[model samples]
Target: MARPKILVVGAGFAGVECVRRLERELSASEAEIVLVTPFSYQLYLPLLPQVAAGVLTPQSVALSLRRSRRHRTRIIPGGAIGVDTAAKVCVIRDITGDTVAQRYDFLVLAPGSVTRTFDIPGLAEQGRGMKTLAEAVYIRDHVIAQLDLADASHDEAERASRLQFVVVGGGYAGTETAACLQRLTAGAVRRYPRLDPGEITWHLVDIAPRLMPELGERLGDVALGILRRRGIQVSLGVSVAEAGPEKVTLTDGRVLPCRTLIWTAGVAASPLVATLGTETARGRLVVRPDLTVPGVGGVFALGDAAAVPDLAKGGDAVCPPTAQHASRQGRRAAANVVAVLRGAPLRPYTHKDLGLVVDLGGKDAVSKPLGIELRGLPAQAVARGYHWSALRTNVAKIRVMTNWLLNAVAGDDFVRTGFLARRPATLRDAEFVDAYLTPEQVREHTASLRAGLDGPPTG
Candidate 1:
């Protein structure tokens, strides 16, 4: 008999962890583990700001999937465009645009998320995102290019627009992005001798009442103070009302001439969820405590795509789309999948909060591990130490550590790869945001193929 195919759609923290666990527990005869993702590497997303700041190379944070000792896992370099639950098939759009159906005995959906964008005028065309490795790398080059252009321009207006930068969001992602890149320009400006450092300004704004409300008042204030001390304007209760190539209008009635706007506002569940034709809570697919989608046998969902109930939090609360929760959910989901295979009772997922860490580049960090809040050098130490330990492989750990050391000692070469220089780095150009299907479309496609009317997969 053919082995049961265990298909996981995504290679993010959750999907990667789930596949790794399945490979460990199930033998070659038990199940075949198949992973679907556009990228071959599992991106360590938390340190993306460092990548943008020129403190770490892009490849350093991208953990490769083809690591040693995997017996049953097959990597599919594609994105799941739709899922046909009744047919137990997943339709995928490969890198070259061809489509195919992957049938599975068991399925895990962990497609992660896309950047949460808004209806602000010109934002999609003008604003940049900080969600992906490509975005991070592109931002670094783009920021440096601005410095180059500003230095060469004699016009004060052009210089001001070129020198000014803006970041929207007060969460860890946004705050750290603004803080790190501000540090990047603060230092890199010295190399461009003609450009006045005073002209370089970074504005961090959010619609929230305070910065990093997850850090509570104290540590959040500490982070806020550090940014202000370094000349970053921390403006809460405001966000980009409109964005254009040369200027930004704030909701608080402030107009700023800026060429760069990095939007780290938040993320929504991956579009894959919409194609499943299932219930969702604010964009995330609804899953039971056992990580199973209701009425979808042998299928599970986790990561940013699933609204897995927070058994720990209890009552209506669901797990937030965080790396910590996703990683834990992956392992538990693997176990549950094993139980389903053996006709055993499935176990529910539960985990306590492990606290938060914000690496504000260099020697600045804030951490609340095990309820102990820390800041400054102590926090930086804790933050890096946690990240170093969380790395899945020794190779990744070594690469990241070497990057930190080399960055601290030799400093950034401030070189741009220029591969993506010509490409516009906005959301519309950079992200595959359009590659999605409606539930009705998914049902139609899968049904047609199942009935042997399979023409070209795209048809």
Candidate 2:
């Protein structure tokens, strides 16, 4: 008799929550849990815009896996490249670059989502994503650098182009990104007296009809109003049709010459989902209400990577790929895994939409908590409080709170650390392109530097 090996993929909201619950509920003698992920920390993605705006430190958003007491579970520092269900094995490439096939009695697939990119000419190579902590930090540095370049430039055209910031998509990520960056540039401009704050334009464009549409109609209008009041030009029913080295053609028959384009369009399933060689709905593994892949023994899927049904909403539709739903589903999936071992009844995944919060930078936010729409500081309080409460680790929560407190009295530091220049890895390469570095090298090196690694070698 052997302990059932429970292998969980991903370290995002879903996977981390699942692993945490399993550690608490399951006895060490009953099961052997293995948590596999590319990184050793779980990222609090909702507050990523705060990281981008230099409002909160980057490390504050990442919770360490080592800090969590897994009890019996082993944390594997690797990603599952392929899953062989029939063989009951997962092909994982460890930190040492060795590919090992480990057999598992049960598997939880929460590989998470990747940036949903399009073939919209030069997007894949040029554009940046707002998914990871490194990406957020890179954006902050990049924005500051742009302001510096704008102030230093003599040519009016070059200066204008440098100051122009275009953000694509009207979703939560895009909206928050635009808001944060807009505020960052406005504050950063004070350091550059030469640069006119009015000249620095922030344009937000989305193909959808409204911004923050997921937050219901009233909240969407509230979010739009906040952005407009902040002088952010919101263009709905529009998209960047084409983007060149220094220009972008909008779908609304408008050509905007700009240097910076922050693409926060949307997310697709991870490449790992395709590698599973199983049936998927729009790159997501279609899973049952129990969070298991139908007819696929020993395989379970959840999170943005899996198409789990929203039984609460009814009628054949899968749940939205959100942290709110994914976190709870993770707990249920863990319980079901234990249920199979103990001959207990499995629970069906169902959750009522608890509304959404859109942080519109500064103290402006729109929220709908328990179906009640709220705006301004009230929304902002709820938004920040919710994220702070949900943040996984105590260290992260404390750091985030401290950062916020400091930011309130003292404004953002516009200074660029020039940290990424020392490292070859980039937001476009590692975080966006899905390129995992081989054994010896790490994908995100400057991450350590941003995490309070003291000044360079005192030579």
Candidate 3:
């Protein structure tokens, strides 16, 4: 008899963890594992702001899958476009635009998420995202280019517009992004003799009443204070009303002239979740406490794409979409898969909160570890130490540490790669929003494909 095929979608923290555990627990003769993802590496998302701020190189955070000890798992270099649940087939489009139907005895959906955006005007066209490696690199170069342009331009209005930078959202990503990039500009401006520190402005706006509410009130207050002391304008309970090529109007009726707008508001589950035609909460696939999709046999979901119930929170509390939760969920999902294969009982996924860390760049930081609040250099050390230890590979850790040391000693070069200068790196662009099929289209395509595979009706 052929071995059962386990197919996992995505190469993020969840997907990678699931595959790794499956490889370790199950022998090659027992099951065949396959991972489908567009990229060959699992991106360390939390450290992405450092890449954008020039504190770490892009490759330092991208851990390669080939380096895994589990060499038996096959990797398909593509994105899963659609899934035919009835037929147990996943439709994948490879990097070259070729399509293939991958059959799986068990399916794991962990496609992760894309940047979440509101219906605000001009956001789709004008805002740059910080979710992907390309976007981070693009942002760093773009910010440097702005400073260079402002320094050379004779028009004072144009210079001011170019110097003004705005970042939306005050969560971890948004906060770190604004803080790090603000530091970048602060240091880079010294290179421009014509540019004055007052001409450059960094504004961070969010719809929430406070920044990083998950960090607890005390730590959140510390984070806010640090950003303010660094000259970052923190606007709470507000958001961008309208964004344009040269200016953004805030909800408070303040029109700020800014050429750069970075959006880190939040993220939504991958559109592939909807293609499952299953129940979802807030656009995430609904799964049982064991991480299995209810009523969908041999199918599981985890990570940002799945709404895994938070057993620790009692009832109706689904786990928040975070790396810590996703990584643990992935392991539990894999264990359940193994249990089913071995005819053993499955276990529910549950975890305690490990606290939160917010790195505000430089010596300013805040963290609450094991309910103990910390700030300043101590928090900064803990934050960096946690990230360094969490990195999947030794090479990655070395590269990241070396980069940190070098950055502290030499500072940023403020060089623009010009790779994405002409290309739009908005949320839509990074997520490949155009490639996904509409709900109706997915239904039609799935039905049509199923019909073709099952053959014509009997006469």
For candidate 1, the 10 contiguous residues with the lowest summed lDDT are 450-459
Query: Which regions of candidate 3 fall more than 4 Å away from where they truly are?
Result: 443-449, 452-459
TM-score for candidate 2, residues paired by index: 0.91
Please list the residue runs of candidate 2 whose C-alpha ends up more than 4 Å from where it truly belongs after superposition.
422-428, 432-459
Question: What lDDT would candidate 2 get against the real structure?
Answer: 0.82
Candidates 1 and 3: which is better by lDDT?
Answer: 3
Better of 2 and 3 by lDDT: 3
1-459: candidate 1 lDDT, tens digit per residue = 888889999888999889888988888888888889989899999999999999988889999888857745788888899898887889898999988788888999999999999999999988899988999999999999998888899899999999999999899889989999999998898898898789899999999998898888999999999999999998998888889889999998999999899998999998889988889999999999999999878889999999999988899999888899999999999999988888899999999889999999878889999889999999999999999999998999999999999999988777778858887887866668888888788787688766767752431
- What's the true lDDT of residue 322 in model 3? 90
Local error of candidate 2 at 35, Å?
Answer: 1.0
Candidate structures ordered by TM-score, highest first: 1, 3, 2
Candidate 1 segments exceeding 4 Å error = 452-459
- The Cα error of candidate 3 at residue 217, in Å, is 1.4
lDDT of each model, Cα atoms only? 0.89, 0.82, 0.90
| lDDT ranking from best candidate downward | 3, 1, 2
TM-score of 3: 0.97
Best-fitting candidate, measured by TM-score? 1
Encode model 2's per-residue lDDT on 137-236: one tens digit a residue.
8788878888888888899888878888899989999999999989999888888889888898899999998877778787788788889988999999
Per-residue lDDT tens digits for candidate 3, residues 155-256, read 998998999999998999999999999999999988899999998999999999989999888888988888898899999999999999999999999999
